[model samples]
Target: MTENKDKQPAAEEKAKERNWISASLWADKEDIRKGAERYGEVKWYKSARFWPSMLVLILTWIGAAVTGSYSEAVGVSVILCPLCYLNVKGYRWSLLLFAALYTFDRVSVLYMRAESGQASGSGLWWLLIWWLVIVGATLTAFRIENYRHKHNLAGRGHYVKDTLIALAFPVVLIASFMAYNIFMYKSSLTDEQRKALAFSYGFISRNTDGVINYCLRSGVELQKFPEQFRQTYADEITKVNDWLEKDEIFKSGMEASLQENKEMLYEVFENGRKDLIRLTIAEETGEKPENLVWKTEYDRMISPVEYCKLMDESFEIMNSTGFFDSFVETVKTLQ
Candidate 1:
């Protein structure tokens, strides 16, 4: 019985040794003291006081000039000390200063919005909420720092959680900004309004899709159309121009149709420009005009005026065949 008791004591000692080693490993893994070394080194900058502060002030001025938000830049600068308080001395004073700066910024934004006759909506509410979050996060970070001073809690898992909480405000602010941009894009236009705007911008064309595809396939063919073919195309275009000039109904109908398909026209124009270079190259290669490659190339090399003429003729042909409306609708639904 005595021998067994003695062996049990030795086993306990071994377990204790193992536990101590494990704890030492954890301490090494999560050493906040090593991380704080950079904070300690920042004392030299703090000692320089006026010069460093003035540099930040100058940087704020530069940011204001660049961004056209002087008040915001100044507000950010005023709050910088509190934001960096985790790595600096006089953290309490910095926190107070930051709170004051935030209050001033809120008042200024409200005043500006009022002056501009803009409603104080989600953006203003978000700014207020963000300020509250910043205050809460700053205080939490300070409390954590104070707790670490009294107890060795700095290297624990809780410390990492606290660090994440401290980062949450900035992350939320960035996310809100992104959400606002997306909302603006979606809510700025109605379906009919968007279609009308696109049409007015020059998107209407009976052969827009085929032309765009042809251009994409053989942009170089546009350049290959001999000067004679261009003249023929031009003469055909002039004939339509003369007809539109003489017929008010035809002219008005053409304008209305174009207004409806403006977006498609813009897309085609942009796409055609890209295809022009390719069309020029294809023309030099003697590709047939009716070939997809040649047609695409030809469309790309055609000027806006020429393209409009082609589209008008195509629209007239489609209308005579009773497919103009269907064709326009189909092109409208495409990119």
Candidate 2:
């Protein structure tokens, strides 16, 4: 009887040693082992809420699969599937992991919306719904974990490291994503598109003046291409020359007027600037104020002489590129 008592004690110690070794490894495996010992072979299906929580997760996954791109879906699955398994098996650290992912995702979406200055009510509602569902699923996992603890079925492990790792995941993932983009990036623009964009940028760079406002004040109808062409290349060149002549006349008029009314022009410019500042503020704040329009042509008031010089340079650039000749040739090819 004495020997039997000694052996029983030794066996119990061995069992405890085994349990400790199991628990120290990974929480999910430990939970399953303990749960199986206490709640029969079908340990995972012990809780009534388990299936429901898992159903929510599965549906969320399906939603992502349907809505997201292939790469995004795969990425989400890699991170989410393991969390789902661990969470269902009663890992509370999974909550922190899920929360980290959720925060990153929501923040990214909000930032994009802020940048674009547009977000539909329906889109926001859907995001809210997604958040609520995640919270609900999280609460479900907490309850299961609590139940495991109460039943002496929960895994014994220090989760501090796990929580810290969960927190670091977003940072790592973001860094990896940025690195991938930096290294693997390729331009999607065609050669023609690139050339067209380059030409547009050139014009934009040379546009020091508010050309629309200048044309409005000068009574100059800027020459339109092809549509305004008079059935011959020579006629088109004449039209361009006429437009340039009108621009010169407008510049001469501005210079002479500046000589006469320099101080008056300065006052007009300052007042126009104040009006523009007020207008910009009102627009940004979504407020409409009376007399928001500039009292004078604010754009024309500041550096009218410089504006004429820039316009001449812009014309020179347009002509120097053989743009007119190439456009005519392209149109002829189409014919």
Candidate 2: misplaced stretches above 4 Å?
1-68, 155-335
Q: What 10-residue stretch in candidate 2 is worst by lDDT?
A: 201-210
By lDDT, the best candidate is: 2
User: What tens digits encode model 2's per-residue C-alpha lDDT throughout 217-302?
Assistant: 43332444222233335543443333323233232333344335534533553454465456665777676745456444545443
Task: Report the lDDT of model 1 for residue 164.
Answer: 56
- Badly placed stretches (over 4 Å) of model 1 are 1-87, 149-335
User: How does each model score on TM-score?
Assistant: 0.24, 0.34
| Reference-based lDDT, residue 125, model 2 | 84
The model with the greatest TM-score is: 2
Candidate 1 global lDDT: 0.44
lDDT tens string, model 1, 1-335?
99999999997686556432232223232232332333244333432212223344466689768744443443454345324522234243444555566567667767645433343588788767655554443443344344455455444334455445545645664565446445533233445534443342232232433243333333222332233223434443343334333333334445556545545655665565546545566678776434534345444366655654454445445456764354345334432
The C-alpha lDDT values of all candidates are: 0.44, 0.48
